[model samples]
Target chain A: MKISVQADAFDPGAELNAFSAGAAGAGAVVSFSGVVRDEGGRLSGISIEHYPAMTGKAIGAIAAEAVERWDLSDALVIHRHGDLAPGEVIMMVATAARHRAAAFAAAEFLMDYLKSRAPFWKKEYHADGAEWVAAKDSDEDALGRWAG
Target chain B: MKISVQADAFDPGAELNAFSAGAAGAGAVVSFSGVVRDEGGRLSGISIEHYPAMTGKAIGAIAAEAVERWDLSDALVIHRHGDLAPGEVIMMVATAARHRAAAFAAAEFLMDYLKSRAPFWKKEYHADGAEWVAAKDSDEDALGRWAG
Candidate 1:
């Protein structure tokens, strides 16, 4: 499994290629990407900021935990932190396994953890002004599904 | 999300970027790839062939089903219906969702349907000879998973 923090948009085909590069026995891989969107029928764009070292460390820890928890052959977590406009990418996760279930579980696991566990924060630039979006209680609720 | 059958390897990063292209509301997106493996300990290489029209139709049914089944914002499926080397890609599925679960579920569902329900046949080229591989009973069992 591999994890990274980058400043620019990544190429999904290339990233999938990289993860499949070492695949031999593996049959299935699962991945996810988070992107900035225009929401509320009004918000135009979003700008995000994160401490590079801390964000990378936190993502690494999350990936490590996933490796230990699942029978993954390969996995990746690439996150971007900086100013992003509507339709810009924020992050992505890819998981591979001998079977589809494990890949699915691990992919979902990393995404939920990244949302609730990562220290990186986001500030959306909207029509009114810049605002730091708080992590949702619903997001916490999303994590609940994993523990059980 | 977009799905296709190609003769070349795919880029996961690029597909993810495409899936998340216009959405700013999505906080997460998930994707999965299925690659040809020579590690069945049984094959020296892998080759795939399919009924082109049926393959596209079958995949479209699965992807459309996923959209109805999950809260997905976008989804794509690309598969190659020709010879592939070890470490070469066979197929890929990418998805975008508001959260991870839907993306994860839809991706998994798409994969399961592709493997067992889709209309494609894979032939393995081995040191001994070449033989077509049939979907295992286990693969169908895996399909029962989504049968609700």
Candidate 2:
């Protein structure tokens, strides 16, 4: 498993290739990428802040749980912070397992945790002003499916 | 939507990058890749055969259904035929949408259909002899979850 919280821009395609290569014995791989939407041209960009000391540890713990639960051969998570323009990739998760079901489930599990529980603050910029974004009700609801 | 039934080997990462670029307004992108498992060193390789006239059309119809059901911004399906070595990729499916739930669901739906219903024949090679592989009951059961 690998987790990284960084401000630099990275290529999702390259990262996926590297992760798949490292997953030696796996027969299935799944990946999810979250991008910043343009929001009908009203949005300019977004700035993200993180609790540096706790973010990585928190994500690592969740990723480890996913690996154990799904019996994954490998897993990877990368989240970007700082300023991000519309259409830029904000975060990504990848999982590898012997079966497609396990790989897909693990990837979805990681994404749910990240979207709802990860310690990241986002501020969106518009033409008039910028405002802090709040957690969406849909995101919280999405997390509930895995609670049991 | 794009569907290809071919014998050529293609890079999954490169394909993903191109698909994401074309997705334009999507906020979530999900991908699943199926690879040939080594089967504990007992397996040598496998050869896949398909009905050339129907394979492409069948895949295209399923992909179109997924896009409509999930309201996808884009979708892609690629399946390779001919001989494949252990650890080689057999197929891939990708979906892009405005939300993660739709993207993940559509990708999984496509995979379930491909595994159970796609018109592909498989023959596995062993040290002593080769045998035609049959569809797994588990794969068939997986398709039930998506039914109305």
Candidate 3:
């Protein structure tokens, strides 16, 4: 498993290709990417903040849990912080396994955690102003499904 | 939405990039890829045969169902037939939606259908001989999850 929290822009295509190449024994690969949405053009962009020291460790733990639970051959998580425009990829999670179900489930599990429990703080900037975006009940509910 | 049933090799990375570019206004994009696997080092490769006339139409219909059911912004399905070596990509499915849950569900639905119900027939080649690969009960069980 690999986890990265960086401010630099990344090419999902390139990253995905590299990840796939490294996962030699995996027959199934699943990837999920989160893009910034303009929301009817009212939003200009989004600004994300994170604790650099703790962010990678937190995400790594999440990825490790997913890898272990799913018996994944490999997994990757990449999150970008700072300003991001509409259509820009904010983060991505990928999982590789011997079967499609495990890969898909692991990727979704990572995404649910990222949306609800991860340490990233998000602020949406609009034409009028900017405001902090709170975690949605839906996100929390999604994460709850994995709980025992 | 786009669906292609081709015998030529494709770059999943390139297809994924193009699909993401076309799926604007989508907050979540999910992609799944199936690679040819050589189990126990006894396998050489695999040969896939498909009914060319009906393959595209069938997959397109499946993609349509997923788009409408998930309210997806866009969807893409690509399948390659003919002989494939280990580690080569055999098929891919991508779904774009306003939310991660919808995107993930739709992609998994497509994969389940492809594995069990698609028109493609697969034959696995080994050092001894070649054997036709039949659909597994697990694949049918996976598809059953989508039934109403």
Q: Number of the top candidate by TM-score?
A: 3
Question: What is the Cα-based lDDT of residue B70 in candidate 1?
Answer: 89
lDDT tens digits, residues B1-148, model 2?
A: 8899989988889988888887658999999988788888888999999999888888888899999999999999999999999878888899999999999999999999988678999999999999999889999999899888
DockQ values, each candidate: 0.62, 0.73, 0.74
* Model 2 / residue A101 / CA error / Å: 1.0
Interface RMSD (Å) of candidate 3? 1.2
Per residue, candidate 1 scores C-alpha lDDT tens digits across B2-24 of 66877776665566566666445
- Predicted complex 3: DockQ: 0.74
Clashing pairs in 2: none
Question: By summed lDDT, which 10 consecutive residues of candidate 3 chain B come out lowest?
Answer: B34-43
Query: Against the true structure, what is each candidate's TM-score?
Result: 0.85, 0.97, 0.98
Stretches off by above 4 angstroms in model 1 are: A51-53, B1-3, B6-16, B22-27, B40-42
TM-score of chain A of each: 0.90, 0.96, 0.96
Candidate 1's DockQ is 0.62
* Candidate 2 C-alpha lDDT tens digits along A11-115: 888898888877658989999998888988989999999999999989999999999999999999999999999988898999999999899999999999998
The CAPRI quality class of candidate 1 comes to medium
Badly placed stretches (over 4 Å) of model 3 are none
Q: How far off is residue B68 in model 1, in Å?
A: 2.4
